[model samples]
Target: MKRTEVSFDIETIPLTIRQFINGATIYDSSCSEHAKTLFVSGSERAFLKISKRGTLEREYHMTKFLHQHNVAPNAIAYESDLDYDYLFTEAVSGEDGTAELHLENPRKLACVFGEYLKMLHSLPIEGCPYGNRTHELLNDAQINGIDLNMLNEFSYSAIDNVVIHGDYCLPNIIMDHFSFKGFIDLGYGGVGDRHYDIYWGIWTLNYNLKTDTYRDIFLDAYGRSNIDDDGLNYFTKLNKLTD
Candidate 1:
């Protein structure tokens, strides 16, 4: 699998809009044009994640941290000139779960992904320095020009302990034929509640496969027989307030 998969030690080249718009192969899961990914040199060897100028810097910091921790792809370069933060990372050696072919065994895939989140949550949160309480999240949103109502009455406190994936979705996970390889798109990940990732994980499986068939199987595989409905609902409602 490693030999067959395209990999690269990509050079330090500043990605340009022309290359992104013209020659690069775009990823299907792109949230938007600014949030899109470009396979810069083709062959899936390298890709550049381009985002608006000043939204955040956690991807650069967190990707490098997780890569060093042997949980993500190695970042090739991170450039922020004026506007737009471009993150260049080497392609991981596997098919992302978003690939249509990998959808063959959605049950196994859900279980494996659930286990990955469990492993991620087991990691200690000590020294980790991202994510925040609801107030902090709302504050940051306001700073970023997001209009959010004052939800101060809500108990928006930190429920820290487990490390969360932030966006615990299908595409963020990389797997080498049912074996977990690494994680991607981890800007929002840090110390947080495990149930949050679990909720999102289940959501993603249901969403991506267009079925809720394996939600219970996924939770069972994660060894959580009793789900945290409160935390799940909490994060869901919080996302509505802030996003």
Candidate 2:
């Protein structure tokens, strides 16, 4: 693999740390092409993620906060330069849900996701902070001149809000031998409508497995006797427009 040299202004660098950065393997794991994640293995494995300056603090603070809640990795190192932000965190040790072991048994894997997600959503939101509301996100997108083109506002009064993994897809979830470990790519996570997560989870399964065969099974496993078709369709359309 070709290495992308990431340069920053530093007052000093010890020889050992400089060499470690050079030897680390850059991972092409993120679905977002703009952000870069590198996996470094030594005494312990850690992941270093770098992204543009705009999201520097939001991701750093959220990941750190989630770690405090024991649902994500500890934020081991963090720094920001004029152009980019760097965050190093302990790796969530596991194979992702896409691993063939899980793929061979899709129903079981979906059950794992279902149960784990239920636990995540139940985390108390009282004093827990730092999440972007869906309304605010849509407003920000419109302000930036994105073509929303007649998306109707959904009633918050009707929808139940829960802690959501803003991008709750298979790849972002880590699994160890079909057992749930933890979550990754939590930059968009926070209190939001349950449908936001359900939409993405189903979409991700459809996307990765190259079929929609398992969508209903996933919902059943997640313990919903009836599907929320209205909520799912609304959020899916909204996401496509804003995304």
Candidate 3:
């Protein structure tokens, strides 16, 4: 991969010993055409996230949208460059869901994740303007010479128009201890099939843990029965091939 260097100044923030332990070096390598990086300064306790996208306009729009809906990290500061089309924002405190949770019970974690998905799916999708991820995924498979027979076996039964985080994996979910704090990576966020998000969530766990027990927990919490097992199997197989 070609690395793009961003010309910018580093801003320092105060932190304690505990904060120093948890901070990480944050970078923004989002756009395909341009490279932008955000260097977050702090320890693991608390830090900031500076991002550079393809355009500052898009980032501003997204930031405003997330803030209006109360769905994004706190925006403490921002800067834009018209010539470079770069934008930056502060990072929020919390660990991605992919990190181990301190839950006394695994089932409880699944239930909490299920409920979180439900809440996300409940968001109104009338004016969503993002890409259709299901179509994109299927298209990418074809373009990459991946077999879609597995995906074809699944049924698109429920096409509920809901706001879906295009990348619905554990890493995108942030948690404070065992409780859900918020979500990240909204660049691909938009309205789409509820199953698209649900299926991916289950698939991620199955891939990482090589178990289906958590899948059942999520389904039960969603208050639904009779998931298209064949469909899930197909999508999972397709995901493996493409991934």
Report how far off residue 149 is in candidate 1 (Å): 12
Using lDDT as the measure, name the better of candidate 1 and candidate 3.
1
TM, every model: 0.75, 0.81, 0.65
What does candidate 1's lDDT look like per residue over 1-243, in tens digits?
112223333333355423433434444334545585656546436767778875437877777777776888887677776767777777787877877667888888888887887778777666666745334555676787665444344454437667677888888888888788899888887776776678788788988899999998888888865356565666666566555
Ranking by TM-score: 2, 1, 3
**Tens digit per residue, CA lDDT, model 2, 36-111:** 7766665547776778766646666667777777887777767776787777778888877788878888878777
Backbone collision count in every prediction?
A: 1, 0, 9
lDDT of 3 by residue, 1-243 (tens): 112334333433222222432434544334333444453544432223333435444444454455556666644444443334333444555666655552345576677778888877776665565546567667777899986664555564434366777667766677777577766656566665666677878876665556778888887786585345655565557667877
> Which 10 successive residues of model 1 have the least lDDT summed?
1-10
Q: Candidate 2: list runs displaced more than 4 Å.
A: 1-31, 144-160, 225-227
Cα displacement (Å) at residue 101, model 1: 2.7
Q: In terms of TM-score, which candidate is stronger, 1 or 2? A: 2
Best by TM-score: 2
